[model samples]
Target: MEKVMMILAAFVLTSTSRPPEHKYVYVDELKNWTEAQRFCRQTYTDLATLESQQDVEALSDMATSVRKTSELAWIGLYDDVNSWRWSTSDSDFYQHEEMDFNNWQAGKPNNVWLGLFRDSWKWVEGKNFSFRFWNEGNNEPGNNGKEECAAAHFGRSGQWEDWPCDQHKAFVCYSELCGNASLPGRKYFFVGELKTWTEAQSHCREHYGNLAVMENMEDVGTLNNMAASLGFTSTAWIGLYDDVNSWRWSVSEYDLDQHQENKFTNWQPSEPNNDAGRESCIEMFANGSWNDITCSKLQGSICSEVRDSDVKFTFINVDMNWTQAQSYCRNHYTDLARVRNMTDIQKIQTLIPAGQNVWIGFHRPFWMWVDGSRFSFSYWRSSEPSGSGEHCASADLGNSGQWENWDCDGQRPFICYNVVCGNSTLPTREYIIVDELKTWTEAQRYCRENHKDLATITNMEDVRMLNDLATGRTSQAWIGLHEDVNSWRWSMSDQYQNQFRNWAAGQPNNKFGRESCGALSADGSWYDVSCSQTLHTVCFNVCGTNPTFYYSSTKRSWTEAQSFCREHYRDLAGVRHLSDNKVIQGLVQRAAWMGLYRDSWKWADGGNSSFRNWNRDEPNHNGKEGCAAANFGNAGKWEDWSCGEKKAFVCYAAVQSKHLVKLQLEFPSSLTEDDSAMMEELLIKLKQKLKDDGVKGDVKVSWRKRPDGKILHKPKKKKDEL
Candidate 1:
């Protein structure tokens, strides 16, 4: 193999992820999952779409350094195929060229669909050491046996490179393949011997269409089993793809009814997501089940109709939260979850590891149907939520073949499933937001009416997350709690729970008559407010991490604070209105009068240093005195200090440790537990640090009304987050 030099090793996987509307870049230099999604949305766009093999190829060529050991970059759809539709528009056409110009700054497609095909990762060449992308688990890197997505690229000038499919690198995903290459159409009847999937797709496309598109479960089954019977293990192309659009099947007039089952078609459990138009093709897993995955995902697949029903879908052994599991099933399986028989249970058993019990469709959080029918009061192996408010429940196959009651609010573990297992299909469920805004009584009403309860918060992260959403607001909404007719009961039902009461100050004391609700507030605090007050509350939907590192520019001698902020912080902190500036202007005046001088009492970005007290009649610099600083003393007494003057600096860094921001978001990972523990330490340390540094007078830390109402110690439930 002839290798050319000159390619920069420092690869940059650039992508234009579409946020709610704007486009964002990954900036891999410093990004974690949460912040990465935030940056994509709040800053740029949502994420890049890797819809086709060509798109994957382009991205690999565009990305960099896939020397066989690179991290598998995330694309749009591993989670659920149905939800696999593009984040932007699920419309039929995606203008590929229009994307070339809109690609985000770089390193995007940060988030990925959470699907893990059985351990078969697509590498550059061989297996094992050759694996380029490294998925967190046996999650399908490449859908079928052959892995294609293992190939990723960075930079616009390098050669397309391949890596281990599981590698975790930022990647570029294209919506469609922009090229002149087009396959012609034709007809065939298995002339004599069998054909490799690749060969079949190529020949088929050249004659019968660009790869066959399987329409339904029957169609997929009809094809894969045929290939397996033929003893084919190679890869094949399929008409099913999401690039440009999802519905435009790769092949023309691809029909299933016209063709009869040819003795070899078959499918695995819950096959064919057709999610957002995903891997509509078939690739038999080593275990004989059919994995309907992403075409670009690159796996060893075969052509022809599926013919096997005995093929059980294999589950990728990956750990996921209940909400995540639900989401995954919806995307890939086209439903919530199913519980048909013991085999289905065994199939699901493959998802989580031993010692971990997760929530499945058999949960009875609110009401349980007696043989799929009504409000039957049923108690399980476990007792009620005696102490801690446990809202969600799970199956405890650990003991008797019955369900066990655990706190769904706890977020322990979860599993996803497909159909071929012959289990009944999953049902639909509309959630009641535990983190939504609602009054105590109002929240209870909403929960009772719906098939849910006021969302119960279970962890510190949830408390902090809820608070983040309720920031700048007053009055906390209610969480699922209250004195239900004299007893401390959960709105969902009386399930067995271990922990309880997370109240702030004299909380849940049945204030003013009786306390009937609990709520989380802004600032990671939990509390019990009066049931009558109106405030935003949150609901748990079950969800999901990562932080990016940021280092600000050191010194530029900005003449104006606004400019200084503009050059730094990426932009200015909330300015509000000019009236606010008027109040600040007075401080500039005093600073100028205090023996401080620049060309004039200039601002940091070079404007009239109208701070402190405008040295009598100021504005003499004609807005040129742009350096503004607070007087050495006085709360708002600002001054125009020289840009060259060196003073104690306040450096801003990207809050790399959201879970540990209170520890000053330190670089030392082992410093503290997380926000719940360190927040108290931070408050104490910040006060002490400020006092010792003498900045107490210069800079003050104003305490805002704690939204959660709880003191720094009380934690919350994880399910109560947005």
Candidate 2:
């Protein structure tokens, strides 16, 4: 059954001298699950936990009274899956079974379309130990009666399967020390005789540590080498065995460590169905609703903190979003309340007089940055992000940087950040200001071409920079923050990789479940959609050089634009400077194409900073497209694009900043006209004279029109003067 898992600790009121009531702090902040936990632990008790229906009612009442929107305050309840340990008994390997809890970060062991296959299998390895390459369908472990031994199919995607023992087939052996190499040797050899799984295990145990325990892809590669060397083809047994119902919670039993069984079960209807055998983690919505979900999806979390004082509870009365509340509690009180026994539950009932929802530290998994950064910060608007289709996030310049959820397909303005070049100075950071209303992907391409890739904000400093840039702007703009949901990457190769994403409401629907692209919508939100659809794009180029962008009215596929760019100039335009965006934005009116496309959401700079700004349910991956674009019409947010779509595109050329300045010179009327003509000749002499003067920098001069919009020329003699 999928029930919200929580860590319980009892605090009983020993003396009647103490007040019969506990204080429940209602902090209103917007933070992800983990951040709230830290806040609660540091400031107050852990997130409020409910021991009974009465406790739930009390918390609900307080939440209903205080909450501004339907946003649920975090509670001390979460899923405890992915906490498997290895059979080897070394706890280190499984310490973080929940390390990259999001399935996108570390694909889970379940039956899903993972590329192409749906097989049910169990890891004999500890609940913490999860690593597999199983074959499709019935070839998986526990597939047939009496099929208990596991083997690797070397030729076909290196997947694994179970087979009956006593079937004579080749086998691979594992050794912590093999062939006297001292190294944990995986020297596999084709043991010619077909033996049952048990027999193979015994033989390998005698010769080495055990049958080849394939730990990672590297081990599989080693097996491939062994198979090639021996030329033995057919099924080969390895050490893996099946213990089908071996699921466990990641929560430490030491909160009573000895108790492994879940004492409580509160599952929603049709929940814990183990959909596709992947829904192992538990979660609860506001209203005390409980359900099971895959560990990979992203959600707000709940955390606990022990209090040194005698007070069993503290109620924060501030009204912040979940993230904000978590930040407040962490700074002042402990984390969200962590209710343990019925005593604390009763105390909570007496503490809060109203209903309100707040944030606790609970990790509900979702799309994660491939760089593996923490999901700590969030800034969501009220009653925002309400949809199941797909969503992305956007920041409203009109609303003091407040953000709202949006659709990836919708076009909008966006923001992009740059890596600090020389030092930690404001001038060292480059920002691209793409004014053209292009799709998020196009803006990203423009930014990459002129300045850096889309802006990648690191902390509040970056956000401030964006706000400062948006001071007089009415429409919000696009930033280099977006998510593909399947994975996150950057468009440019020279920029830093920061995990900062902004999605919109129910965006990224991935309508048809194949939309792997991203876009920016109006309201500065992000969305996902098929890349083939055409939209406006932004482009940028090197300042002081020839025009950076080359607009072609003839629409072409993204691939074709890339080809055209490579052939004529450089690969599609890359924006590396903020000024460059402003320069290029004036060139296009409608949505066009840029070089930016979705490739597992990796950053071009490769610096892993996990910061996401998703609007709401987003990155739906509809239409089987895998590209990205920037939407300038909608405030420059982001959305997905298709590589094959034919759209107007922007290309750029790289050039260094020119130090020379253009000046218009007029000869004094006193001088003869011949002197002005001789001025050109005199300039040659002046150049030599300056060289003799030993200037540190080179000086180059060019002709320019006068302030009156006319080229410099000898003033015509006034007729009266003549």
Question: Model 1, range 1-722, lDDT digits (tens) per residue?
Answer: 10001101111223365211111122332332222333333322233543334444444433321111223343332222111223445344556533223222355434545331223222211213321332323342334531233322222111233332333455332212112222111111221223433343343322221233222333334333444454433323232211111111111112222222211233466654433322433333444344444333422111112123222333433455434544555455433333233454456555534543333322111322111112223324455322222322332323321234333333322211111111111111222234454434454555556544443332222232334444444332333322222233332212222134333565444443323444333332234434444333221110111112122222221122222222222222211234422332332312110000112121121222111222223212232222332221321122333233333221111111112223214335454334546656666777788688664333434334357653333345488673
Show where candidate 1 strays beyond 4 Å.
1-26, 65-69, 78-722
Lowest lDDT 10-residue stretch of candidate 1: 1-10
Q: TM per model?
A: 0.17, 0.20
Cα lDDT, model 2, residue 409: 45
Off by over 4 Å in 2: 1-182, 189-207, 215-217, 232-254, 257-265, 268-273, 285-290, 308-722
Global lDDT of model 1: 0.30
Q: Please give the lDDT score at residue 173 for candidate 1.
A: 22
